[model samples]
Target: MDEHSTAAESINPKHQALIDRLSTRRSATTTSSDTARPVADFLSSFASSKLSIEQSLSESRSRADLDHISSLDLDQSSFDSASSSLLPRKKFSFRNKPQKKEEDPKNVAEISVEPSAIDKISSLSVRDGPGFRNEKDTTLVKDFRQCDVGQGEFTLSDLENCRVYLKGTVRALFFYRIRNCQVFTGPVLGSVLIEDVSDSLFVLASHQIRIHHAKATDFFLRVRSRPIIEDSNRVRFAPYRLTYEGIEDELKESGLGEETGNWANVDDFKWLRAVQSPNWSLIPEEEWLEIADISQCK
Candidate 1:
């Protein structure tokens, strides 16, 4: 008591109180929070409230590795690699009309005939875009859940007799040589280009649309601007009829939050007359499909 009381009295009361508070906090943190934590325990607690960036990145990389490993197709044949690939890398050979001697024969395609404000989007490199190319007779589904594209172009080409679903937002969409297929997609924030399509059904939303050399097809659309058809015919138009989970958020993000009733306002570039263009007609309400629910398709 003599030695202990002498040492205790040497420390000030305020300093002793601070020392006790610090000891309690360090003990509580180390024992209750800094140690083992339940991965799924999301209750309001220090462990759940703040996560370190290194820990978050480590978890993300681990989850990605697991997903990649789980999605590996063990039964995929060698032909699978040759048949389907990202669009930008594939070569699309569309022969131009060769009107003049100066035009290169490489068939440089995609920008519409009469350019507009969106022509600047041409700077988006096709090779850098994400898409599906050289696929046929198979079901294709793309759910843009993570918002991977930013004013990026997407393409679907050389497809036939397939049910394709694209649910998300994109800057531009291109459909080339699609036949006897049913294409359902989300909002094209910029423009949609369709070339050489026939006997197909398309439900799309876009700011602008251009169809060339299409025949006997049906279109359900929501357009912010007048849609143009260069050489298309027998196409029917109706209101856009495609839906999926989280689509409202995607549409809102892409500036297609509201229906503009412009699907029927199609302008035929070839038919500039006072009379209605015979190439396109309105689909009777009786024949119009229900708002297609692609949420279950995938």
Candidate 2:
């Protein structure tokens, strides 16, 4: 019994010495001072030291009980995996610059022109008779079938809740700030431009159609080129469905007699992606209206 006690005393001192050496090594390896170290880092260090001490105690127990130690084996890989998962994540940062605000559309239009420019616009000649402008809650009709060949451009501006009809060929068509209106026109030999229109319906044939800042509008068009739009949303496209007396001759003269089927090939300048643009879509056939016959409007 004395010999056994002596052996236990010697083993206890050796184990305590080993624990002291491990503690000293851990302190020496630590780079950050206690004042500068984050709380999370300090906690991680404490956990690592606690795990080492537990491992040392288990090893000492194994030396004392060989049969029990043989039945228990430590998994180093699993321990490392658990430790990695428990570690705190690093911080992230964003460095984007602030963007400038866009100008108001109403204010931009009010200051878009100088006094001299306004005068110049007023002085411009309309040899093909005056085009409709600033009309509201009224029906305006122009029968171009009776007019001469050199029909100039037509303008529809600031019209609200109005119905406009034009028969026969025209050089160009321009529409601005027209709301809740129905505009049915004959073939246009040149391009058509529409801006700031909302809740409107348009049926026309043109070489090209360009729309900007329009919302909730539907276009029934026969266009020779791909129709384009910018800053427009909730707009739908369908084939032209207008019929009138001598309309075939007018369409032939304007090079729009054949249905090119380009009306649904819309190009949204704001959307450039492989998927279809959300701003425009083909009108479902069930929702399409009957062919508009304006021959009786006169």
Candidate 3:
């Protein structure tokens, strides 16, 4: 009984020391500081006891136990292979910037066509001519009473009035000053002057006209019996013939106008517009690159 008690005391001390050594080794090797120390200590004690059992075992028993343990270790390795699928994924690598693609030159050109367009039928009259009162200051109804009105020589006013019809083209786009006439300030009438046949945008009678190279049409100007009121109290109407003389001076002078904005150089193709509006409303998708014929309509 004494021998057995002493042997147990000695085994207890050795077991405790083995537990302490394994616990220290596990702590040094593993990063899992959050794991329970009691659980690790229990596992270490279990491992030591199993090793002691194997060392003290009979040769036959040891062989059998070792075979069994080897089979269990193989089974554990197989389980690890299965459970490996549950492991955390590695970080992924991705490209930061995308590559630029090459564009076909023809496609680029078609996409960049100008939006504004010029209208045809450049000339139209706001009012029929040949009124007796050519100028307000030059004529007086009271003065006509004492003078011979029938003996007057032929004048430009008379010739202007005698024309039964006038035909011309729009040379430019302009705005008429509404205050001067009963008509409101609006789209310029007689925009392109048909003095002869000229293709250009110019200013006329102090009005600015921007000439834009455009596919043309021959839609006649439809004048309203009543005046049109637009954003301003201006009458909006189309006209025939836009005169270019004033626009030439403006282009040569400051080389700028309301239509061109900051684009002053005449030679710059980027400065070119068929008309002054910023919208591409009239252009068809297919005909963006092609010019419209000025002489006829499609």
Candidate with maximal lDDT: 2
Specify the poorest-scoring 10-residue window by lDDT in model 1: 36-45
- For model 1 the local lDDT of residue 144 reads 65
Q: Evaluated with TM-score, which candidate comes out highest?
A: 2
TM-score of 1: 0.56
Q: Put down candidate 1 lDDT per residue, 174-283, tens digits, no spaces.
A: 88778899999988888998877899999998889999888999999988998899767899999999889888888887788988889978899899799999999999
Indicate whether candidate 1 or candidate 2 has the larger lDDT.
2
Rate residue 108 of model 1 by lDDT: 45
Ranking by TM-score: 2, 1, 3
What do the candidate models score in CA lDDT, each in turn?
0.71, 0.77, 0.29
Cα lDDT of model 3 by residue, 127-193, tens digit: 3322232332221111111234221211112111111111122223222111111111112232322
Worst lDDT run of 10 residues, candidate 3, spans 177-186
Q: What is the lDDT of residue 204 in candidate 3?
A: 26
Model 1 regions lying over 4 Å from their true place? 1-128, 147-151
Off by over 4 Å in 3: 1-22, 26-62, 70-298
